[model samples]
Target: MHPLGTVLRSRYKIIHPLGSGGFGETYLAEDLDIPTTPKPKCVVKHLKPQNQNEVLLKIAKGLFNREAEILYRLDKIHNQVPELFAHFEENGEFYLVQEFIDGHDLSKEIIAGQPWGEAEVKKLLRDVLEVLVVIHQQSIIHRDIKPHNIMRRRQDGKIVLIDFGAVKEIKCLETNTQGQVTSSILIGTNGYMPNEQANGKPKLSSDVYAVGMLGIQALTGIPPQNLPEDPVTGEIIWRDQTNVSDRFAEVLTNMVRSHFSQRYQTAAEALQALTQSPPTPKSDRWRSLSNRKVIATGGAVLLGSIMSLYVVSRYFAKSPTPPNPQAVTPQPPIVTPKPPSTIKKFSQLPCDSDQQLSSPPPATGKPTWETDVYKYYGQINQKTKEANGRGLMAFKQNNFQYYGDFKKNKRSGCGRLSYPAKSNIDYYLGQFENDEPQGLGYLKLRNGNEYRGKFAKNKCQGEGVYIYADKTERDGIWREDKLEGSDNFSCKGSSASSMPTISFLSPKPF
Candidate 1:
């Protein structure tokens, strides 16, 4: 353990040890470099090797750097994710400096025997799922998600996900017949982790299960491990323990299904279903009636005139003529059409924007045709004569073309910016605002590298993940096309400066 007042790198001065675990220990420290009135406090995680082994140390070093990189990237992606300030290795011991979240963990709020209301549980689920949506979008499955790992910030009360130590891929000094290192390091809490995660084959849906289990604990006032399960199906049997709406209960049941395949594949899908879930009934009688199920035709069934003979006998208690089971004609089940989506569809655009022209000339030679930065075609404002609504714009100078929705002469909706004349395929297809890829979008470069995430002002901003041609990914927050963080390590080869970098400059095709 680091002694009090010990300063590492002549910068971070340790204040006190926060906690310790099997892998490492965390300490609260102060950054002396920043010249603030009160030295900003940060959390320092110390990862030490079990023993001095050359091969094991090399492997652990690589794993530690990779984990730090992941955390550094995720920090920029969302506010709820703690920011990673720096990571370093001092005297064979690795350390990570992170943002000190000033808040208490969910364990304080979700106490045993102190159950939360349905509304409170629902709010927690929504908050966690929203953060999971961002994390999962980068193809990351948070193996460990529990009350202790999640904190409620004291300032704003937002749920902050902490402690990604489990995400690190570390292995012991054990080799198989092929001389490849092998170690089974199962990462996750017992109660929160599902079966698949426990077996070390975790999926995005596995994280969803953990979040659902947390919600159930909050509602039932019982720890997830303490909750009873079905003897046959192995599903959690907690409905009788909590007073929640059938709609919500069904959602939670599906989320915690024993089979990963039965659960929602992604957090976004789960969030959508949860948001659309109906509210609780005003009366228990109404809920009971709504929850009623239809029995088989041969048994007691409840419907208008299709009541079975058994149902008629029990309800009426009188001899009534029942329809012949063999003669009864079965009617097709009625399916209610889903409500129209609130988001406007790009296909609803009035003009055909997919048509690509070889040059900047219109086929019909319309007189409204004009040019500024590029040749414009399709619809135009009758009064202002500016490129408005759905249209196509081609720039011969940049050898680029744009096709899709436009508003008031700006690309303000769904659109595709591509370079047809180029030897390689390069394009950006997604939401646009003022001729820039704004909000969620996909950018694929000619070199096979791709970026999938949020953008703003023609730059990769907010949470995004850049996928290299070799399949390795870098996930984090971006501002004006740059990742925001600093890394200075003293290890032999674990310095962030030694790591390779990639540029995501906007092509300015628009």
Candidate 2:
């Protein structure tokens, strides 16, 4: 190991030893050549060949230079990868100086026996997989991927992969008299390595297995080696130890499958599966409405309050797929009802006949018009024939679907608006004016963020409470959707009334 304060190439002043691996030792150093108030610090990796044979050294040098060139390209392409400042051969020793990430390793956050929540684990998977996507796109495979090798950057809280196995892999290189190169040693942790990887054949999916093991360790609160394995199938038996959704569990399982071919072929494939939204179940559609209503009411009335709404008999004609109360398209028709329909079905609606309502509404929109993406059913003005009272708008396209009060076809009363498919916002349940959210309401986002308090012209204004996915709560005043000040605010009138929007008095049959 280089002694403390030792200077290399008359430039890098070695500060201290970082760690030692099978092939090399790392040191923290200061670059004196770089002109800065405080000299920039960098990580120096010293790789020493096991043998001094002239033929072996020549082969190793070639391999080392080739790997360094690719790493340089990777650094320029992705900020997450450390930038390769310089590489040199000093007295038969190979040294690599690179950008030093100012953050602790993931092992600190992923403490053994201290499990992380599903949301946090999911975020970690995305952060790591995104970087892997860029790395793999360049036809490079990260042979070694573990918690200790992944750094959680303090500046922006991004994940940075470190300690590429090029140096370590070179240790296994050997050349025969025929001048052919061969490798025998595997380059990965045993617990995280799959069968193929352990056989000295690491694939892109090998890195995916390591990341999957990291997630399992966080979820189960157990080290990868300590986790039980299925002896018969040779797969890790970890599902019983964690409380994760079945869909998410399946993704993780597929990533860590024992067979490399059975797993996702690339990081991009794995990331897509992780973030893709699962199809909503058929039974949970109306139950979600009742549940949201119960939550909005703070469990004061439960399902009984929603049960009081008058149900139109037309909804009973067909059992449709369950719908998530989120918007479908960028534009919707509720804000401005269409002109008098030539279909003549508007006059056929049973608006005056009232009846007791039961069960929940289906996901499909009524009338099934080929051009119309949404259909509104409720009170209509006798003279103008426009939506004039409480109504339920079902959407078939990607746009906001409103369930609330209306005046002259404009959303101007207490109601809930479902977000579109691509929007980060989930559902906004509160008061509306001129077809936009206004006044108090509860807004839920797809990323597990929630805002409750006040809104004006579709922006978060006035005092509100912002709850982050990590369970951090911020009570503050916001302007134009940005938090400006911290203050106490009450969200009392945000809840919608128990009165249903779709009353039996006005029903538009398909």
Candidate 3:
């Protein structure tokens, strides 16, 4: 209808865009002014009407305003959820600006699929229980604990719960949401929702049930529906579920029990059981940003969120370029017990001295994301001429090197980063102020792709360009790390997806 890239309510300058679900659009924006801010990019999710019905938009707008009222109260107590940014009505459209997560959704991870071995499910549930404890302590019910609403921040691989506090999330996780329309139309998804929630009563145990089901899903690659379920009883069908332990199954059984009384009555109880002194599998992914404090401020407006988010210092925005993991193509269904590989370390690199420049990665076959599974585990110095002129911070887990940057313990710089190996590719090197990749730097990827530019907080925010291995080049402004501004005539085609040349205000909570 309106031009494609229309700027909403004034303050939010959309960098590029994230996905748009039943909720409204999400953007990665920069706060106009604020240095050393957490979540420099913000996600704008304008409230969407529940139904396509005409009058519903009007009612939805009213309910949308109530969200801010709710947040303001919660903010007073340091709620970890998103802060209410600018909420406004312009041209009959209502909008909201909030925090942005630089990570993948738990649902996407589940759908894409991974195995949950040993105490993996227990650990995941325990992490959730802790969040719920905080939420319950705050007197809030995150009725929607489904995968889609739960995000895994790539920074430290921690789960950052989003989209709670809404009547919709409340309705979905706790009450009979789908195929039922009493006070509210069915708000939750099918399958994972508990039976009580499906019938109408939304309670704490209902969340426990869904979370239990999430455990089964995590352990088994199948979705809840695909898992066995009693047709008459509507109970989870767990008989033929292989690789699941009796004790673990018992844990889920008590959790997802049909009746609320049969389920874990409270988050504390659930947390207590899950927290049994069991040794966490070293390879299981548990890194997270939950511990990081996020300080939000509009001169006293953004105080609800913690002062920082847990994340290794590095840029996180990825190019929209489709993932081509064909190099690591393996047999379908990656189940089966495979001992995870260890992250390679620069400390383990040959010639750990300062005289000779560390050698560059062999320039023959381009290294696939798989070839460098342990790449993130080590400090990669592309500057092989002498001592550490430039390098990336990497860790190891799940057979790859997770990467980023490390100077002290702060995520102080930027580069092409990846999850698990949890590493980053340093494209530029130089001075840093406020953590943005300020000063001069050069990034040379193992794939022969490279970029040398002036960075701001890691993004090519000021001005920069890249010369690809195939000879293509891009020039523009970067928001988080993706390009946002217009590219030159020739660069437009190849640089179409990643908005690296973007510009916006830095992220400020609230």
Highest TM-score model number = 2
- The local lDDT score (0 to 100) that residue 221 gets in candidate 2 is 82
Per-residue error for 336 in candidate 1, Å, reads 28
Q: How do the residues 111-206 of candidate 3 rate in per-residue lDDT, one tens digit apiece?
A: 424555645566668767777776667556666777887765533345666776354431112124463422344445676677677776677777
Best prediction by lDDT: 2
Per-residue lDDT tens digits for candidate 2, residues 392-484, read 776655555666767676776556767566666667676566676666666777778677666777776776677667855666667766667
Clash count per candidate: 3, 9, 66
Candidate 3 segments exceeding 4 Å error: 1-4, 33-39, 48-62, 72-80, 108-113, 165-185, 276-510
Give per-model TM-scores: 0.54, 0.58, 0.50
Clashes of 1: 3
Model 2 regions more than 4 Å off: 175-180, 281-510
TM-score of 2: 0.58
Model 1 CA deviation exceeding 4 Å by range: 167-178, 278-510
Per-residue C-alpha lDDT of model 1 across residues 432-460, encoded as one tens digit per residue: 76666666666666677766666666666
The alpha-carbon lDDT assigned to residue 426 of candidate 3 equals: 28
lDDT of all predictions: 0.70, 0.72, 0.50
